[model samples]
Target: MLRLAALDGQVSSWLDLFGPIVFYLIVWGLVFAGTGLFVGVFIPFITGDSLLFAAGILSAGHSGINIWVLAIGVGIAAFLGDQVGFLLGRHYGRPYLDRRTGAWVQRSIRRAEKFYTDLGWWAVVVGRFIPWGRVLVPPIAGIARMDYLKFVAANLVGALVWGVLLTVTGYFAASIPAVKSAAYVIGGAFILGAIIAGILSWRRNRAAV
Candidate 1:
């Protein structure tokens, strides 16, 4: 059953049968033990957006993993990961960030803290789409000492939406012919522009200082 669905022996029949479930188990195990957050942050940077999108494509297939189930799994993984991150920040990371007192860290943390406060738990939801926002925001929530339940609830919703959206986008992207290339070109251009703008901002700030 699993073999027929995945069509790849390397992925394993059990994986096809309970692969995603297994994945959730392993991912959460790491999170509970406090390593999964590292995986989540760097996986995006290393694999780029394609992997999450691929997961979506997998979910969309006639295979065992449906979109809703995938969404729930990913959501649970992300929430648990962030919860660990929040705990880490509350216990360890936040103290370092707070003590460093460097202007940039201060600025970043202040902005994040302010957002967390003003928006309450919803900031975690909005932060899901923000790249680096996801990385910093949970820690901010922890440092800010926001209600854990509220944070968890918001994190669950945000991760579900973001996970589903990215996967669905990947599905549609694969479906289109020219759109993939176009998306690459557009995304590349946007990144280049952001880099250039960041450089200019740095130079100007340097000059001012």
Candidate 2:
């Protein structure tokens, strides 16, 4: 009797009874939207790449929310989150940098200010793809007093592109069984890849210094 009650739980049965495709869309859509908002760019750096690849494969396999829609939703969320990050940088950036007495951050701000000055708007555009650069770029733009309109425009475009690319890659990865099986490996690789790329970029920029 107890076993039957446990087996008959409405929530479990409801989800279990639903079509797998619908389940995937609802699950991944929410995941994309929620994670996109709370975490922003970090999502891709973390579990985002694997999760997206999984979603893509599922979408390829069955009827689910259109991949384009998923991309747009996640993209918008990315835009909003980054906008918030930009605003935070614009308002609070100076105080945080000034109050914190870390040698690393100071060196970073010095380099960033120089970068922002020399490159003008491209710093925001290219920096979106860089790890710590993503966090630092917008604020640095604010600190350097780059044109508000230009900074916002670059940020919006970069965020949208970042969101869409990561989502699509996930979808593509899911399409291949071998790739799906290797998501754990791929996810780790993506993280390392981003880190390596960021370090290389930082070093190259430093060398140019």
Candidate 3:
């Protein structure tokens, strides 16, 4: 997305043309689609991580934007976006994918399937932090026929965490050093959380048996 943004200085030009509010409305839409929409299957390389981080930096000093509002609004968009993916998948997942024989399409489906198989419900949350992972988890979960209640719980937690963490880090990156490191920490936390959840689940199953 950043690369796409840099083309002919479009992002800069948009900020100049639309100012903050309208510009961010566009950002929220992109984030929603990139992370939560099934059409994201085609545009999986979107620079949402960088986009959110940059938005946070702008929110720090950019008048007319509040970090909390940005975080919550984007989070809600992300959550609803996943709902769309899940619903679509529940109704037409495999058939839809069968129609898509593009190389990227197949590869993305395989990777998303791997994540869903390996992580189960946690994939929905951890995938939010991983690119391509976020794009497909929703539909993947639906195709797997996961419980809707479980999917919603994981989606809400993932979106809120992703929204606040990146936005806040970017806000501080406006003044602080190691903004890059903060991103690493966020990614690490998601992977580690998935691992821990897996371990606990294994233990619980063993105990029940």
* Top lDDT hit: 3
lDDT of 3 by residue, 1-209 (tens): 35634532554455678987887787788877775555556654443666677677777776777878887777888888888888888999788656767888788789988878767888888888777678777888899899999999999888888866776777787788587587778679777978689667756777999
Which stretches in model 1 have alpha-carbon errors above 4 Å? 1-36, 39-43, 47-50, 58-68, 96-111, 176-209
The list of candidate 3 runs beyond 4 A from truth reads 1-10, 45-47, 199-209
TM-score, model 2 to reference: 0.54
Order the candidate numbers by TM-score, best to worst: 3, 1, 2
TM-score of 3: 0.85
Give the number of the best model, judged by TM-score: 3
Report the error of model 1 at residue 121, Å.
2.2
Error of 1 at 13 (Å): 16
- What tens-digit string does per-residue lDDT give for candidate 1 at 19-131? 66674454234332322354434334322244445554544454655556554555666667777768877777667456645575566667767656545556677666555
> Between prediction 2 and prediction 3, which has the larger TM-score?
3
- Candidate 2 structure quality by residue, lDDT tens digits, 86-176: 6666777688556645676567667767755555555665555555455556666776666778777876766565556656655666545
TM-score list, all predictions: 0.55, 0.54, 0.85
lDDT, residue 135, model 3: 76
Q: How accurate is candidate 3 locally (lDDT)?
A: 0.75
